[model samples]
Target chain A: MNAYPSKLVERAVEQLSTLPGIGRKTALRLALHLLSRPKLDTHTFAHALTEMRDGIIYCRQCHNISDTELCSICASPSRDTSTICVVQHVGDVLAIENTGQYRGVYHVLGGVISPIDGIGPEELLIDELIERVRSGTVKEVILALGTTMEGDTTNFFLYRRLQDFSIKVSVIARGIAIGDEIEYTDEVTLGRSILTRTDFDQSIRF
Target chain B: MNAYPSKLVERAVEQLSTLPGIGRKTALRLALHLLSRPKLDTHTFAHALTEMRDGIIYCRQCHNISDTELCSICASPSRDTSTICVVQHVGDVLAIENTGQYRGVYHVLGGVISPIDGIGPEELLIDELIERVRSGTVKEVILALGTTMEGDTTNFFLYRRLQDFSIKVSVIARGIAIGDEIEYTDEVTLGRSILTRTDFDQSIRF
Candidate 1:
């Protein structure tokens, strides 16, 4: 039989190895590290993980994670409520926020449409988003999902749903990213960059 | 102010990032992955970590992790208790066990002697080990610690202490590993391999 110093240590390693990107060796190291620390520190770590999982609430309006009913972005009066930036996950929301380029609230779809994964439109917050747009307060819906096939499928689906609302629907621009060398850029991105080249004045503003 | 969608998420990410090799980005991904799983899975994970920390016991004889007063190795009657393999941590014991090369028991020092880290002989299980050797049943003590300065210091200290007990002391062999080519091998290891070259028959047995 395989030997572990203790069943408790083995159980902790097993649980930690279940995390993404962590293997058994890494899990053993992390488990030992936790064991070496002050007992109070490990207690705090466990408490934080459990409490975050159990108590975190999703924003009612936009389905973003929030401590309260409305997320900070949705609660702020300064953000443009008329424009909603649509994203696939909370991480994307943070990435967009880091850019400091947009001052609009966001609607998180939880995930994009992936039929192979059995994730359909009904599994997402599409109905809530449609209702928000129908309320007449929203004037524009910006699609900022990924560029994968699933992302494209989700964008097309959302566009079809919002067609009769008389609200403007737009997609985030995609091409060679800023500071990327043109020679090293992927063929599809370089072709799209030329086909959808922005005016000189607009490019200079960015 | 630094922005996080929720204070709970920020706290979880902070706690997770405290683990070795887990950066903020990876911690955030892990936290989100846990949140996406069933609430029961996360609860189980947290419970395992906390329970392991608060309830795990250390074997009185060898200071290895244990569910009882004596670790399984220490309690077993079939194992060769007369030959103790001393290591720096519980993980080291597991690693050696996985090799299936040794049948002797283990003594975990918890850490090596390092003046830079303020860890001295008193901080480790050196005194307990000396007492174990003084019991006279132990015939040999193998030092299986790392090759670092701290490991050497600790090994020297233990060797000096065991001198008075009449127990045979040995260290695990150190040289270029079997799979490593001489061209890519480091200078110190190559020199050591030549200086401590084993007899052909002895090497063939391994």
Candidate 2:
């Protein structure tokens, strides 16, 4: 009268349900759809998933996804090393890169500081960034992180840490809404907006 | 400027996009979410996808998904062998299986006969089913395929073919709306609804 769906279907259902917005019914539907596919297609799909897990490594320099020791931006000699853009995540790095205007390198903080989530300065890559700045290779630090409360907290922490440094610290400007996801924005507007960003402290001249 | 997203991200994105409703944005969001997760969690997630794809195979007897040559229903000697339920896809099998009443085996036709899509009887596994029936191991065939135009067309074709056999032929109730997906219906309604199915004849069935 009762049995769990086969172990494979159960596993597949559980995994698919973990994705954002997918429910048990949707997961079952998706699993059934996938099962109908030819074995090779499913195998290839699985292989891709497995390879994705094994292949991507976080860049040692900026924390962006990379195949090698550094991400593309960190490896590129043509990029402006004097200007480093700090962002909340690798996705943010991609969002800024999609503009094709920012020739400077980047630093991904892994995530914003959120007390609610128990994330703080020690949990982020702020110490590595401070060391990078202190190494005398950077002139400007573009704070392109989100404008959320957590983003503000991370930004303030960096501001205090870099108080004695000679680098110019600026945040990306306000064409973006406070609660919006940056990845969905158009490249041109975001580029124009980033280019026109104001300094964090107006009293301190560069 | 034209470089693809890293191979790992691209692979995950491609696989995710192949799902029914996922798009590139959603795929990327999911990929980044998985990327940000701990290594073991990501590995387990990826492994589940791959294992489901590779380990699961169609049951030779019922065409339902299974890890073995025959599905659980087909292997169970306790189930009725005289009545074989025919469905358009495996998902229909799950929908029917959700109802505890049906104790018969199943036959999956892969898809309906869609003239517009150039799908015909030869394209489906109908011939194999005819052979299975002719072997005298079956007495009745209940058509659980949907009520779409293609489904009707396929049913008509199958009905004509099965007319030669002495076995009784019936259809699941037309209580389902034409073009309605069976997966959306609840178990109790679907179960009680199937008990009252009208006999099919092109002229008087509707």
Candidate 3:
């Protein structure tokens, strides 16, 4: 390991390396880059991080990150309140929002059920989701989660919880992507795409 | 672009994207990671960057990042102040020091002479280096710089300036690396390695 010439640089690198996916070398590079930049840039970077940590709040209804009690999607009057899309992380909510295909609000479950990691349904917002469904206004619940075992476990748990209610429950469809070639597509996805194939005219705009 | 559920997240992502090598997607990921961590972690990260930028001082003699008036290498009595190694940046100084090979002090030139980048000799610390040489205590000045065209230009410029003095001006040697095979070496480097080969007995100890 290389010893830094400056103690300040060493400290900066140490702190930066704590971030996920960043290692010692990248931390050193980031530290050096910050040193090369102006004081205002450093101040802005620090100020943004601190402000985000101290000020940002989670939505009371869906549990997504928000500036107010309700996230923008949850608070928007035009969004359908009857349909809720349950996802694993706040980033997923942003991803769905970016797609612009879903018009319903989101429920961020924080993470999928991972027993090996000691995470259970109680660790997530599963109970809050149950409460949201019990309110009787929700007509449909969409499971928008990863295809991992943990995601499947969480989805099944949520299914059991909401099965008592008289509402529709659906999981997002799985298929080969639009631009993917069938020859190169994975066998499971190709088989599932064939099994779930819609009518010829329904699959395309005539 | 995805619309962040929170304005704070949007602002945080915007600030993080300004960092070198970080794109909007990576910035968003970083911001979300910060949000997932404790407030203390965020505080520590922010404090380190701001403090490093605000507190780090440049060595008066070597122009390297330092906590004191002189860098640790320049301040140490054991290091040979008479023989100075000149390099491009503080990072280079750290890199050379890590090797534990050199016993001399350093003079950082900040950057190479790049006319395309609008960085000339005046933009660098060339004049300060000459002043140090003129002090008459320097016996040798090693030009430890990169092998690029800009590095060569700067090396030539520095040599011309130091030729009037009685001090020895030399460049660091370039050759195939220790673990590298001669067959894989580039033609220019292979030919130069042959040209600069030392006596067989002197090159290796028995």
Candidate 4:
């Protein structure tokens, strides 16, 4: 006779082992622990997972999770409509939002302009961003991009396009080290960067 | 701003941080990694967790995950219905299932008798197991309980009660360490325990 009796448990462990950094032993342990939970708890956990899959939808306007066409920030009347924070991805928007100090809306670039990875400005949402800038409602463009080669290239590309517009172009503060992530940074440091941001010189445009 | 922008990602991290051994930074990292995965993957992961929480119902006959009155093991035609392997918990049932060698059904005691934890025989499924024995279909009862003090007490109690029934009662091999779990024991050692099981000499029924 074997030590365990359920093939279901073994199958569940095999599935979990496929996840990043999880091994077979760890997966088995986790699966057993999961099976130990109350049936109601498991049901609620599964329901939440299903809801996360089915309920979450990208905001058409700002590419954030939203029920409607636009995100809550885009629909808000209190936010400054004249300014927008252009970020590398959807996660950056949350990092900024956590501060609760920004009054402007956001635009997700989908990704940065990486030449080596074959990611070009044409591949990103830069054209749509230019369209937003040309709409005349936005008077300021905040470059909330990350500190990477792609971030710098995207910033340069956007700067060249926005040179014709008489709006202000600014970058988030540079206390964040090269290759460091803003998401993991403490609130105080991230908040400090927001307060002491530098203006992008118009001469560097193009 | 961070590279990612999902607020739900941030909220999820915050919630995850509340779990044991999970800190805020680790939570954020795990959340971001999860967010990076395809929506379907996240849904599946959540579904697994939820299924662990709710979908599993203990079999009425053998106290394992089952859709009907009896567990798969108990309902199987090829299994030895006369011999039942007794375990401390449903998890132990799973541990035994992993070996794929056992041809008998299982009886889960829910937990061992623990005076410190205030758990007694009435709190477990011992009475129900005794009733199953009294029915006379069972010829042998294998005690696969843990080696803890509570487990020993529970095993002794079962041995005493089952002594009235006209059947042989055996205890699984004692090579398993006093504190070690049967679940974590190597498959080879576990197999040996099942093969070289000893008769419960304390029983008068033998």
Number of the top candidate by TM-score? Answer: 1
Candidate 4 lDDT over residue span B1-206, tens digit each: 34234445445655545444557665565555665578787776765555444445678877876544677788789999899999987667766777676888889888899988998789999888998888779999999988777888888999999999889999876666568899999887688778876666743453
lDDT (0-100) at residue A117 of candidate 1?
A: 99
lDDT of 2 by residue, B157-186 (tens): 999999989999998765565676789886
Sorted into a CAPRI-style docking class, model 1 comes out as: medium
Worst 10 residues of 1 chain A by lDDT: A1-10
Candidates ranked by DockQ:
3, 1, 2, 4
Q: Which 10-residue window of candidate 4 chain A scores lowest in summed lDDT?
A: A1-10
How large a fraction of the reference contact set does each model reproduce?
Answer: 0.82, 0.49, 0.89, 0.27
TM-score of chain B of 3: 0.93
The candidate maximizing lDDT is: 1
TM-score between model 4 and native: 0.60
**Candidate 4 residue spans exceeding 4 A from truth:** A1-57, A76-83, A100-103, A113-123, A137-140, A145-160, A163-206, B1-60, B67-70, B75-83, B99-104, B114-119, B135-140, B146-152, B165-206
The number of the candidate with the highest DockQ is 3
Candidate 1 lDDT over residue span B28-134, tens digit each: 99999998899899999999999999989999998888999998989998889999999999888889989998999889998999999899889998888888888
Please list all clashing residue pairs in model 2, or write none if there are none.
Answer: none
Backbone clashes for every candidate come to 0, 0, 0, 27
Cα lDDT of model 1 by residue, A117-205, tens digit:
99999999999999999987899999999999999999999999999899999999989988999999999999988998889999898
Q: What is the DockQ of candidate 1?
A: 0.71
Off by over 4 Å in 1: none
